[model samples]
Target chain A: MGITGLFLISFLMVHCFLNSLIFINDGGETFNLGAEFMAKNWVIRAMEIVLFGGLLWHIIQAAVLTRENKKARPVAYAASNPSANSKWYSRSMGLLGTILLIFLIIHLRHFWVVSRFTDEITSGKETLFNEMKEVFSQLWVVILYCLAMVSLGYHLLHGFKSAFQTLGWNHVKYNSMIEKIGVIISIVLPVLFAAMPIAIYMGLIK
Target chain B: MSGNMNLTLKVWRQKNKNAEGKLVNYQVKDISPDMSFLEMIDVLNEQLIVKGDEPIAFDHDCREGICGMCSLYINGRPHGPKDRITTCQLHMRSFEDGQTITIEPWRAASFPIVKDLVVDRSAFDRIIASGGYVSVNTGNAQDANSLPIGKEDADLSFAAAACIGCGACVAACKNASAMLFVSAKVSQLALLPQGQPERYLRVHNMVAKMDEEGFGNCTNTGACEAECPKGISLSNIARLNRDFFVAGIASDN
Candidate 1:
């Protein structure tokens, strides 16, 4: 889980940086070039397979772990005060992941499916940049993107440090630093990702 | 008398392991504020005995917090609402005059219910038996200064050893994972030179045994640390994971 999770984390950084080209605000010309490079570059094209594999591996591992965990306690506590001990998001990883899965499907339908299957972008009939403006132009899509980022933020907040702890990389001296960095990554990545849709919807990134 | 509590108790009553258990209500009046929670239960049991009813059967010994034998999930929190004390150490003064206290045994599949308020925690014993010890030649005691140890390592080992093998970590965990308990046992030994001979073997075997015993996987929820009566740190768990991974690669068998 930790290995795959770290892989996915790194993927998000790349994805975030690549997508941030929209902030160039040049009517998607720069963003389209970046997207074109991502599509035509053989290295990235190959990595897309590994990225999907990592995501599937993570989801499957979570499902199995959650199942075994549920089986450990057949009889639920009649009353439990879990809030006294752990954070709500820490305990709700499965739920947050489910939400992300739904969000991913919607996101893929909006862009990945269009670009890969429909040939709209490859045929020069449409550019990936215009696709973003068209997609984020809707209020509902922007709101949905924002909500998904919130979920991603909370998920990463617990996941980042949790992966380190699982890998046994903890130290008295470095633990606080890891935790602090986790908080920063959780906040910054989601905020940056969310800002894109909001920026586009508000006509700031045309 | 003015400060004494008259509280309602909803105690779980089960005849035996296979019998169905239910929360049966009983009233105990004029309980002294100084009485421990178990002592309060003793009062209630005494009342049941006078009335020719079956007294509540619960496991307890050494009434101090060290025994780890007193396993009660009181009012949702393990060992009651207190932060770092067992049920035996929990005084009745923590409650109000009319507060209704609900008590139940630890709920986990691996730890079966032996009777009311008593679950079989022998699973933990089995996990310990697997590899919680170091192999030493049966000979004269070694010189005390022969194996010089650093203070930080010694303190960390002592802190890890403070785990009383209470099942609160399992009960408090939403997943019923025994990671904290097993990790504490593993950490205590891994930090010392005395435990160096079988360090990799101990971790490898113990973790395998723990998985065989059907404890859940840890999700790093931090509930175990929060509810642990002995304040066992989660760092021990991190150590366990680290050692286990190393053992998987390094251990020959």
Candidate 2:
């Protein structure tokens, strides 16, 4: 689970960096070229497949673990003062993860499915570049993307370190440093992704 | 009359785990401001017994902050409003005259009430039982200088070791994750050279025990740190993760 989780985090960093290209003066052509490059590359395609697989595995494992945890305690107390002993986000990962999953579906529908099926502006298979710009042009779509990115940020903040801790890489000497890294990665990547849509919606890069 | 004050106390009363509990109010006259919180509770219990009412049940040992056995949810705060002190150490002077103090036990799913205000925290014991100790052979005590541990590592281990197995982390957690408690125990031993032999199994067994105890996973909200009487750091949770990761990989291999 830790390996898969860390790999997913790395994927997010790369994906966010790629999306942030919208903040630069891409003039439509840069995005189109990048999109074409991804479409044509076998390695990227293989990675995309692996990314999807990892997402499925992670979600399934989380669900199983949550179920097991719930079953371990058959009786629920009338009052729970969990905040007395644990972190809030660690307790709420399932909720945040469910929301993130919903956001993921919406994300794929807006970009992945749309690019593959629609040809309102360009021919079908025109490239993800045009689809991204079209989606960002809509104010509501941009808003939803930003919201999802924020949720992702919160999820990652708890999850990044949690994955590490679960794998037992936590040494006191490097523990604080790892936690700081988790914070930076969770915040920076999502903000970078969110910035792309915000920049485009405001016509900052156009 | 200056030091003496009458106070109203609303204390949680439940006959047993199966019995429903309510906050029953009692008026205590002539409470000294200098009396410790537990002493005040003792005074109230004495009054209750004399009146033929069942005394309120609560947990306390050593009456010091070090034991971590005193678990009380006082007026919307764990261990009362005082920061960095256990319920046993909180003085009655923290409250004003005529103030109504509400007291309840640490409520969480993993901690079931054995009686009123005293939940069976043996769940913590089980997690510790899983892997809280080093596998050192019983013999002559090793020389302190035998292990060449760096000062920095030793200091960090001691800080993590300072955690007294208080369920305060579970009580403070919204999800009741025992990551902080378990991590502190795991990291303290894992950082030392003497603890090397059992390091891998320690984290794995302890985390497994933590899960078995039905404690929730760590969510990284840092509430445990804030509420910790010993101020155990959240970094211990991270250390636990690293150890678990390596253990998982090693086991897989």
Error of 2 at B201 (Å): 3.8
Candidate 2 stretches with Cα past 4 Å from truth are: A65-92, A117-127, A161-188, A202-206, B3-8, B98-100, B129-131, B134-150, B192-194, B251-253
Q: Which ten residues in a row have the lowest lDDT in candidate 1 chain A?
A: A75-84
TM-score per candidate: 0.98, 0.83
Which candidate has the top score in lDDT?
A: 1
Fnat values, one per model, are: 0.85, 0.37
lDDT of 1 at A194: 98
Candidate 2 chain B lDDT trough over 10 residues, lowest sum: B138-147
Candidate 1 local accuracy as lDDT?
0.93
Question: lDDT per residue, candidate 2, A1-206, as tens digits?
Answer: 56778989988877776666666675766766666677668999899999999999989988876775565444444344456544666667788889889988988888777654576434644556556666789998888878888778878888888776666576657778988998999889888888877877787776
